[model samples]
Target: MKDLDTLKYFLGIEVARSASGLFLCQRKYTLDIISEAGLLGAKPVNVPIEQNHKLGLASSPIFSNPLAYQRLVGRLIYLAVTRPDLAYSVHVLSQFMQEPHDEHLEAALRVVRYLKGTPGQGILLRADSDLTLQGWCDSDWAACPTTRRSLMGWLVFLGHSPISWKTKKQTTISRSSAEAEYRSMVAVTCELKWLKGLLLSLGVRHHKTIKLFCDSQSALHIAKNPVFHERTKHIEVDCHFVRDAIKDGLIFPSYIPTKSQLADIFTKALGQRQFEFLLRKLGISDPHAPT
Candidate 1:
């Protein structure tokens, strides 16, 4: 192992070791964002989005200059790299990039305001936590108002530290929630398989079958079963890939209840209480806490 002084950074996220473990806040970068958006003194918010709020393609008056909205949204997207808590909200606003309105701009500013309050918050990568790889996957059925596309989200952890995650709209629409979730599992399986290979190359050996937790029983059945019918025919390709991975011992997709699904935080909006619960589950610290 290299000396403590020699360790600089990893994956663009700076590192600062301490007696406890490592402190990993991007305060300087976050401040720069706040300054750039002229929101350094803006009122801080408790949450990224208001309770029960719905945002969709605006049918109202357009902004005087759409580029201004685009610029702000662009900055928020960068902020989300270390703030998975804001992923779903940022993504929802991003869909309005083509023609954003005053309301959408205000909603995006609320996220910035939230960031103002929690600028020091970041994932804590404890030194002694087990390095075993574990993951959770989830999806929201027909969550997008315009396209009716399901949102798929997954988070991979090296012990308690989240190393990778994604929140994206499925490429194809699904007829049922089961199919939407199964497609998400397939996506997560493909990612886990690649990560396994990469880890092996780096001499980080792990079990042959990486366990992947999902919140859909039907999806798990489809991956574990070989039967193909009309309901499963449309997603034949994804089904085959996931099943093949299971057969080859590359990934083991298991069932997890919706309440415990960590990936749900990324796939859609939730009530404030549920959102806060999932946020803590993702290992994000409370910025308001005393340092």
Candidate 2:
């Protein structure tokens, strides 16, 4: 086997190391996407998607080229490997793959334009970051205009470096916001457990209790108290494992105010201020920016 030495690039991810930590981005890949979308010279937006977007099953004209939309979204799905900021937008647009509409393609192109602004932006894994596993989960209740299903999202951090995150639409309908948030808590809890085990196998031992935060006090209450069973009977029995994790001391669930909810970016589109603010919070930076 040929020894390639230190990793510089792998599967489109460009890696760079410095005194602070390891940085990864897809500058070339991003540029290619922008060019393919014919937006290399388009003005960039402050955000990937507009807040309160109307991207649902509507009577709008079907896109002339459905394959183009599908291809763009597929590339974007890979792009999100290092660009979590684009995840929600990609997820939303991906739903119309079978039948992309004009508005959907516009939204996809908007993402390509956004990339033109900072194609080299990526997440950082700081060398000085502590080995702490913290997580935040949020759900946008009934956010889908078509299905009325809630979108659940979460962020898991290894100290200051974000390790894992996802935005997924809940399969079942949630009767209340509390139920939606609680379900998101369950999703993040599973991810945390899986990550903890993976880290342990990699020879990193986490001594501190894993902390999971959420903005819904009602969901927090449901996880911390058994009395809520009567109110949560409709919730799947499997989701109840979140409470078990708490009881077993595997995770500590806490309440965070809405404004401090970093996972909100994953659950729904947000204003420019909140979007950029969360990007900073997520440890994303453009290392290629001019000094």
- What are the TM-scores, per candidate, against the unseen true structure? 0.91, 0.97
How many angstroms is residue 33 displaced in model 1 relative to the true structure, after the best TM-score fit?
2.3
**Best-fitting candidate, scored by lDDT:** 2
User: After superposition on all CA atoms, what RMSD does each candidate show versus the true structure?
Assistant: 2.7, 1.2
Model 2: residues with Cα > 4 Å off, grouped in runs: 236-239
- Give the poorly placed runs of model 1, Cα more than 4 Å off: 1-13, 286-288
lDDT score for candidate 2 against the true structure: 0.90
Angstrom error of the Cα, residue 157, model 1: value is 0.9
Q: lDDT score, residue 256, model 1?
A: 85
The whole-model lDDT of each prediction reads 0.82, 0.90
Clashing pairs in 1: none
Using TM-score, give the best candidate's number: 2
Q: Write the per-residue lDDT of candidate 2 for residues 132-151, one digit (tens) a residue.
A: 89999999999898889999
Q: Tell me the lDDT of model 2 at 72.
A: 96
